[model samples]
Target: MVETKLLMIDDEESFLATMEKRLSFRDIVVNSSSSGPEGLKILDENPDMDVVLLDVKMPEMDGIEVLRRIKAAHPLVEVIMLT
Candidate 1:
């Protein structure tokens, strides 16, 4: 079975850390960011990422805009938006 490589983007630091740990334990490789720009940077640096877990509300950039950018850059990557 192939491992799932995920990028989680959220403004909540504690949430990112907690989710990373829990998901890692389940054999999911999670890379996290505290903002949309940071998440985009991670995606650029790590093109192999399979999925993106994005928070719906953020300070600088919202999830929808981020999703647009992600789809524009890496259309194959799947995204799940969280509120």
Candidate 2:
């Protein structure tokens, strides 16, 4: 089976860390960011990411804007917004 590579972007540091750990246990490769710009940078560096789990309400940049940018830059990468 192929492992799922996921990028999780949220301003909550503890949530990111906890989810990363839990998801990693489920055979998912998890990368994380605390802000939109950082998430974008991660996407830039890791183009092969399968999915992005993004928070809807975030500081610096919101999920909708991030989703737009992600779609513009990497349309193939799937994204899910979390409230």
Candidate 3:
């Protein structure tokens, strides 16, 4: 089976770092962003990522708003919300 690519977005840098390390161990191409803008950029750059793990609370742009844009921009990808 092919390893799926993933993106995890959160405002807390420490949390994103930890999750990145953990997910990478499973041979998945895991990328995490510490802000909504950065996450959007990642989504634009890697249009083929399989799933996105998103947090509901954020500063500049809330996860819900980010998720909305992400879905609008890339409807094919899967999204999992974490609060």
Clash statistics: count for each candidate: 0, 0, 0
Model 2 per-residue lDDT at 68: 96
Instruction: Tell me which residue pairs clash in candidate 2.
Output: none
Q: How many angstroms is residue 67 displaced in model 1 relative to the true structure, after the best TM-score fit?
A: 0.4
What are the Cα lDDT values of the candidates?
0.95, 0.95, 0.92
> Which scores better on lDDT, 1 or 3?
1
Taking all chains together, each candidate's TM-score versus the true structure is 0.95, 0.95, 0.93
Best by TM-score: 2
Model 2, runs deviating above 4 Å: none
lDDT of 2: 0.95
Model 1: residue 44 alpha-carbon error in angstroms: 0.8
In TM-score terms, candidate 1 sits at 0.95
Where model 1 places Cα greater than 4 Å from the true spot, the runs are none
In model 3, the Cα lDDT at residue 58 comes to: 93
How high is the lDDT of residue 72 in model 3?
A: 97
Error of 2 at 6 (Å): 0.3
Candidate 2, residues 1-83, lDDT tens digits: the string is 89999999999999998998788778799999999999999999999999999998998899999999999999999999999
Name every residue pair that clashes in candidate 1: none
